[model samples]
Target: MTAARANTGIRRAPVQRRSRERVQRILDAASELIVEDGLTALSTRTIAERARVPVASLYQYFADKDEILLALVKRDTAEMDAAVDAAVGALSTVSVRTMVAATMRAFLTIYHQRPAFVVIWWRGRSNQVVYDFCRAHNKRIAADLFAFAQAMGMAQDGTVQGVVELAVEVGDRVFQLAFEHDLRGDELVIAEGIELVIGYLERHATPAGIAGVSVQGQDGPA
Candidate 1:
C-alpha cells in the first residue's frame, strides 16, 4: 500500500519541514500523554499544551483526539511492520521456528521502545475506522508472510491464508496478554507463543506438491 493510503488519520499531510516538525511534536505529545495519563485523559487541547502549540495548530493537522490517536496507531504499526519486514527479508532461508523467533523478538523490541503503543492499540479498537484499519493491516501482513513462505518454497499450491491469519491472531493475543501482565512482556508466555506458532506452521505449511507426492488435507500432514 502507498504511504498516503496507509496513513488515514491526518487531516492534511505536512509539506514543509516546519510543518512536519510541528506535526511530529503534536504526535509526540499525544503519545506522552497516553503513556503518562492513560487514554481517558487525552485531548486535543491537552496535546496542544504539551506540544507547546495552540489548539488551532493541532486542528491544522488532526481533526480530533481520535484522529491523533489513529495517527499514533498508524505510526506505531508502521514501525513494527518495518522491523518485521527487515527481519524477514534478511532470512535467506525460511524456517518456521526461526521466523517465529525473529517476529516475536522484533515485536517485543517495539513494545519495549514504545510503551504507549499498548495504550493506543487498546483505545483504538473502540473506533470503527481504527478497528477496520487494523484488521486490514493484519490481513496485508498475513498476505505478505504467505508470499514470503511461497518464495521460500515452503508453502504448497493451496490456501494457507487461514494459517497465516491464525498466526497473527495468536501472536496478538499472546503478546497483548504478556504486556498486560508485564511491561517487558512475559518471557514464559512469549516462548510458549513461539512454540505454538511454529507447531501450527509445521502442521499446515507443506512443501510444494510434486508428481509423486500427495498434499496433506486440512486435518494435517499425512
Candidate 2:
C-alpha cells in the first residue's frame, strides 16, 4: 500500500520536505472538518479551502476524500500499533494480562488523541468503503499480533494465527462498544475489554522473552 494506502490512491509519495508539509496540512484540515462536520461533509474543495491549499494541490497527493480519510486512519493505526510494539517490547517478560492491557491502552490512547478518527471509524461505519478499510486494518493488527505472539514463545501451532485473528476481531468489537456511546470511551467497558482479551489469550499465549516489530524491520510483532 502507498503511504496514503492502496485504497486511497495517493498521487505521489511526497518525497520533498515541502510536499510532506503540505500533505500534513491537508490531513490536519481534513481532520478538523471531520471533527466538526463529519465524513459526509468532506470534499476535495472544502478540504483544500480549509487547508489553505489549492484543490489541485490536495489532489496531487490524494485521489479523493475517502483517500484523505483513509490516510488519516492509516496514520492513527500505525501509531497505535507502534505504541503497542513499544510498550510490550520494553518489558523483560510479558504476561497475557500485561500484553492485552498494553495493546488496549495503546489503542485507547490513539483513539483519544485522534478524535477525527473516532468520528470516522465509529460514526461513519454506515459507509461501506470506510468500513472495508477498517476491517482491513483489523486484519493487519491481527497479523502483527500473530507475529508478536510467535516471538513471545506462544506455540507455533496452526491454530495460533486463527486464534489470534478471532481474538482481534472480538477485541475490535469490544472496543467499538466501548466507544459507541462515548468518544472518550466508557471506562467500565474499557476495563472489561481488557479482561476479556486477557482471558481469551491466557489459554492461547505463553510467556517468553520480549521482542518488538521495530527490531525485525517489518516482520516483527506489534
Q: What's the TM-score of each model vs. the native?
A: 0.86, 0.84
Q: Residues 36-94, candidate 2, lDDT per residue (tens digit)? A: 88778888899999999999888889877877877788788778878877776665545
* Alpha carbon lDDT at 105, candidate 2: 88
Error of 1 at 51 (Å): 0.4
Candidate 2: stretches off by over 4 Å: 1-9, 127-129, 155-158, 206-222
Worst 10 residues of 2 by lDDT: 209-218
For all candidates, the clash counts are: 0, 0
For candidate 1, the lDDT comes to 0.74
Best by lDDT: 2
Instruction: Give the CA lDDT, 0 to 100, for residue 23 in model 1.
Output: 97
lDDT, model 2, position 16: 93
